[model samples]
Target chain A: MTTIQNRQILLAKRPAGMPTEENFSFVETAVPKLQAGQLLVNTLYLSVDPYMRGRMNDRKTYVPPYALNEMITGGVVGQVEESLAEGFVPGDIVLGNFGWALYNVAAAASVKKVNPDLAPISTALGVLGMPGLTAYYGLLDIGQPKEGETVVVSGAAGAVGMLVGQIAKIKGARAVGIAGSDEKINYLVEELGFDAAVNYKKGDLRQQLKEACPSGVDIYFDNVGGTVSDAVLSLINKGTRIPLCGRISLYNLEQADIGPRIQTQLLINSALMQGFIVSNYAEQAEEGLNQMAQWLKEGKINYTETITEGFDNIPKAFLGLFCGENTGKQLIKIADPAR
Target chain B: MTTIQNRQILLAKRPAGMPTEENFSFVETAVPKLQAGQLLVNTLYLSVDPYMRGRMNDRKTYVPPYALNEMITGGVVGQVEESLAEGFVPGDIVLGNFGWALYNVAAAASVKKVNPDLAPISTALGVLGMPGLTAYYGLLDIGQPKEGETVVVSGAAGAVGMLVGQIAKIKGARAVGIAGSDEKINYLVEELGFDAAVNYKKGDLRQQLKEACPSGVDIYFDNVGGTVSDAVLSLINKGTRIPLCGRISLYNLEQADIGPRIQTQLLINSALMQGFIVSNYAEQAEEGLNQMAQWLKEGKINYTETITEGFDNIPKAFLGLFCGENTGKQLIKIADPAR
Candidate 1:
């Protein structure tokens, strides 16, 4: 038997606004020897989500604070290298809350093994995972888009936004997307079949949104809040529904500042804005995954991966999310156990 | 034949913030004789909802603004003195959108005949009317309370709030209320059957709310939006739903004062806060009314009304709303049609 070691990214300090390189530190440590009911995992892909910002702050919130000097944990896809559990495995792919680490050891029951024959293992961190499930329930369950309705999704070229806009189109509704770059906009409209794509960096969003959706937006899938939310909110039609999935734009702010009062507008249009955390629908995760996978196989749903080469670039990968650098689902790939 | 003219309350000027009696002037006008397809109504009761504040402003809204020097209009219950249209006749009690006037001449189709044998015609302006319907759909459709879930409603002793709390209890959920006065608090708990009531003006609302709703709030029916909305927001359970029916607390404010930053809290809890206009649910009005009427008859649902005497005191009644002087539904008793 060969002894194993792991390299992980730990939180060096809590961030004030935007996280810097100094906030994360790379550390190499020997992987603890597998005890009874424990399995050694070789991480294949690590997910970087917007919510991690909340965990980084040592403040009172829904989830516990990410302790300093601890590995930054999130959804990860891994290959089982060795197991001391009943189900002996030498090369089985699994998924769980692993961290920004190359290899680690966890209890066998803590990780769920994935079927590679069905879909790529990396998908367990993306479209067949949390972001995909968020788009599904947030749009269909909360927003409840009806036929002929106009659905506007911000961060349109990103992982969850792309799926949300595509699903809206599949449901026979008008899909409008808002992305940062022209390339992302092109991908959303030309490649992803969105009705319109607005480049938020370009000025006159309110005017562009009004022109693109003459009838007014019926559903707003809010991923990037702030000015985008305010602009989209002003153009909503009567009885509009807003599914608040993520507010990536405001995640870095120390405190919320005075902005255009959307509350007054909400009263006028009788519009609805609701925030959702994907974990609330965990019990129904299988249902969402099954449906999403089926749509993906039928080419009805589309997804892309913004991959960084190694675990060392994990900080860059995470910081890149705040800058809107990644094209789709931001992920970091580790060593392939099969090799 | 008595041909006495009607006295009407006209808006002399648009209010800047809190409306004063000086802004309105009562004027004697000749009552137009009923023509073909018209009905002459002796107004009995006129509703004073918080939404009227928007109408008081000469700006674009879901409904048209009240014209300067024209009679302020809203939900009204009256008795038909004369009619030329089919189905409607003299002595019929009806409800419609009539102004703050002793007499009104309108198209017969504009009025809905109410059966006095079934319930008091004045109720058509209170629990059996717009306020009840507002509470009904706002709580059930938007709030979506589930069994054993904790539901908290602001303005709990008032018309809409009282009904929301009761409805929450009926759905097998714990109902907590927040009111201004100790009397209202007692009434909410002892009379209306609210599981708990918080006097927002008396004590630490955040602490009181925490102790009141130990399990956390699943649905929050918000009629008063300010610090209370912020407090309720902090204590919301994951996937909680907020039905923002009214913001009586903020109607008078001029500047863009910043309330607590709730976007972060919303993201953490995955709570949903939606602003709703009851007219959006017009399609379901019949169903809402039927269910509410049934509930009222069975004594399962209860409501209170703060009736102000005289059409001349219409402005006073309107002003009373902003001060939270009214307990339940606020109405202006225009005249006793039988007298």
Candidate 2:
């Protein structure tokens, strides 16, 4: 057998604040021969999510921190190159938590087959995969958007936020989006059918948000927590529900920023704010995925992705998340599957 | 009917910081003649609670803000001196939302009879009243404490906090109390049967809290929000529940204080923090009060009070709440049951 060489990216240093390309290093190594019950997979698509930033810090979050000088692990859609397991065959598309590399050696149990007939294979890492399920349970289970109620989502053009807005609309609620750029705002309102969208960088956020949500915010899907969230929180109605998902805006800060306390706001309004990760509802993953896929098939929802070509750009794609450079799901398109 | 002069307390001014005696003004008014379905009640005990602090700031809360120059209203246990309604009663102990006055004229339907045979009539304003229900529903409903979990209550010596700790214990959870004084801490551990207690005034709150809750906090009944709540928040375990019942520590501030943001902490742990007034569970008030009464009857919970004598001292007792002067339920003992 000719040894296949793998190009892997590793965490060179733990970031103090904003991460730079210097924090990552690339190395070339020969892919290991698969043991029985193991499969050799070729990376086709890799997901770069805001949550990966939390893994970079030495502190533990819901998931354990990524160790320094180790291969970074994330969601990757791959094609089985060779398999020793009974269920998987060569040329089968699979999804697994694999390294930022050209190839992965995984136990057959760790990877699941992706049915291409449902959607594009890349959607397995984004719209039909983890991000989709995240938006599903977080918004429906926690947010509980009611008919005619207002649901304001921050990071509205991001993968989860875009789905959150459309799902709110499907529930007969008024969907409002808060994004950093007017271009993303346009995509949220015009493309995703959000009732209103605000550009946090443009004018007065409080006034713009007030004009957007005339009836007051009933459910706030918090993704980017900072001054933009501060503006949305001030407009919460009585019985408001805030699903605390991700705080990407605060992920890279060296010093924790002090802000206005929201406890009193929640108190006076008799509101509820609950934080959750998708794995909290891991038992219902299949059900959630089916529902999200149905919405896609019925044209009740739309998905957008910003794909960067080649494996070397994964770190740059991830860093761009902090500056709101990606449209929706950011992905690194590795080589296409070999026949 | 001869005119009966009533000594009523009104909101003289909205306090910018800590409320003083100057914020309350005494006015003399005549008690009107009783019409059909009316009762003339003599105030026996007036309950002073931390929640009233939010109502005094001229901002709308769960209850509307106290209007300036109007009478200050709160929980009052009274003796019906005369009644023209069907429940024909003289010397019947009753509970009503009444003004801070020596006497109140109320519609018969507005006040509920307090049975003296069950407990002291004052218990209708304390342990079996709004404060007790606040503690019960907030801790049991929102906190949802599981057996063997560690539950921490801030402002642990106050009316609601004291009851929250005891209810947590009733649910078979380990109860930890956070108070300001050594005397209060000793009371919590000795008299209230708290598994552990921390004095915020003592050296190293974080160290003391860590030692007290070695397993980390599973539930935090936040009665006083500020630096103490922040300290408790930092040590939360996964799936921790925080019921934001009040924020007495932050109420008197001239300006909103900037503090460490808690959303990230909540997100990382997949925790929940809900704000609620007791009225949020108004439909279940009777059931909550019945359960609380049963617990009291079984000696599973205890009650305490710090009674200030005379109607003239109501304002002083209210002001003392912010300074942590009361050991338990604070009330004014106003001319006991008019014979």
Candidate 3:
């Protein structure tokens, strides 16, 4: 029987503080034969998200930590190379929580088939997928931005942050984005039509944010927590809503992030602050996807992805997230299935 | 012309930390004549609450700070001595936001008439007043404690805290109280039917809290924000609701409280923390007061008051709140209107 080589990345060591390339190890193994109800999938695009950094630590979070020397699992868009399961045929485009491998043998039930004609297949990993649903539910359900309200989003150039700002605008609220780079700030304001964008890495963050949100922040969709959040919390209006999506700033920190305790701030303004993960609204995912897809069709929404070429570059692309390297969803293109 | 001598308490100086008797100044002023739409009111019962501490500071809060040398104004039960206003008549009992004095000249529109026969007139300052409405709206609206959930209350022996625990029991939730003294804890568990009560000043707070709330805290009515809140937050269950009412413990602090940042805790559990004032539900205050009155009539609710006699004792009654010297609602019986 002929055997195919599977190139996979495993967590070699748990990260301390900021993660380095040495934390991951690349291995080659023979692609195993598919058992009953299993399909052989060739990974076309693999996603690298900030949340995955939390899984690298030996701690309990919403999701379990990735075990050492094991294949790191995340969102992957793949093509069925062979199928021993019903309803899935070879050449079918699919999305699954699969291992960081060039080739994956997964249970048919574990992967869902994606329609190639809907939009770019990679979006199943971004705007129309987990990242997209995260932005949708966290902003709309938790933040609850109302018309004429100022909606400030931290980490505004990232996958979820970018969408949160745009959705705030679509809902008739002013969108103010806080990004790290001037280019990301410009992209947010000029391209995504954000009302205002502030480069947190440059200039006075508190002054820029105060100037941007003259009406005071009514809704804050927090994708990056830490000092940026502290500044935003200072300018919150009465009845302000804050949806705690991700604390990307604290994800890689070795020590506990101390604070100007926010309890007083919340108390003074009678505000609401809530923390949530995307799966918190899993029951409404389908509805979110359909609405997002319609918005995409109507030109009411736009998306961007930074695709790094080659499977070997996944670790490098992920490390860039901490340094604010990507403008949108950061994905690794392993191979072109059609080619 | 008959001149009435009005004895009053004024904020002498902003308290550096915990307030002292020196922070208040006793003054005697001649009562000014009532205006066209005003009435002359004789103070009967004056409320001394933890929230009053916030108004003593020069800092801007939900309520404006009490100015130095100006008569301190708060909730007062009074008898209309004379009236030039349409809705008010002489000899009628009323409630108003009036000066902490023996006599006050107030606009008739600023004060509402209280039925003398409906329970004791003092109930208007305790269980059927601001404290009652605070517990009703904050617990039911913000806390949203469902049946069978573990509801924890910090400052559970105080005015609003005691009512919050009783209302939680009425909603079929397990009520746990955190008090400063063993006597207060016993009162909460024994007299109030609280499922459990912990003396935060005694024993290991975290361990005691963990033992008290074995099912984890689903709802935390936080009247005291500081280390006590931090402990309760640590044991919060998924979807925990925290109503930020008051922070008596931190009220006297000269510096801002730092933390184990609670953003991560809220995020991980998908919990909600909301800060609200009773007036936020002013549109429904009537509904809340009526419901609380019905609860009292049914003997489903009970209340306690630490009443210090004599008008001269107002400052002392107010100062005792910080040390947990008073149980339930702390009030100063300035005078008996019938006497």
| Candidate that scores best on DockQ | 2
lDDT by residue (B117-180, candidate 2, tens digit) is 8988888988899988999999999999999999999999989889989999999999999999
Model 2 alpha-carbon miss at residue B104, Å: 0.4
A216-258: candidate 2 lDDT, tens digit per residue: 9999999999888999999999999999999999999888768
TM-score for each of the candidates: 0.92, 0.99, 0.98
When summed lDDT is taken over every stretch of 10 residues in candidate 2 chain A, the lowest stretch is A249-258
Candidates sorted on TM-score, descending:
2, 3, 1
- Model 3 C-alpha RMSD vs. true structure (Å) is 1.4
Query: In model 3, which runs have C-alpha deviations exceeding 4 angstroms?
Result: none
Error of 3 at A225 (Å): 0.9
Q: Which 10 consecutive positions of candidate 3 chain B have the poorest summed lDDT?
A: B330-339
> Candidate 2: which stretches are off by over 4 Å?
none
Query: Quality of candidate 3's docking, in CAPRI categories?
Result: high
For candidate 1, the docking band is acceptable
TM-score of chain B taken alone, candidate 1: 0.97
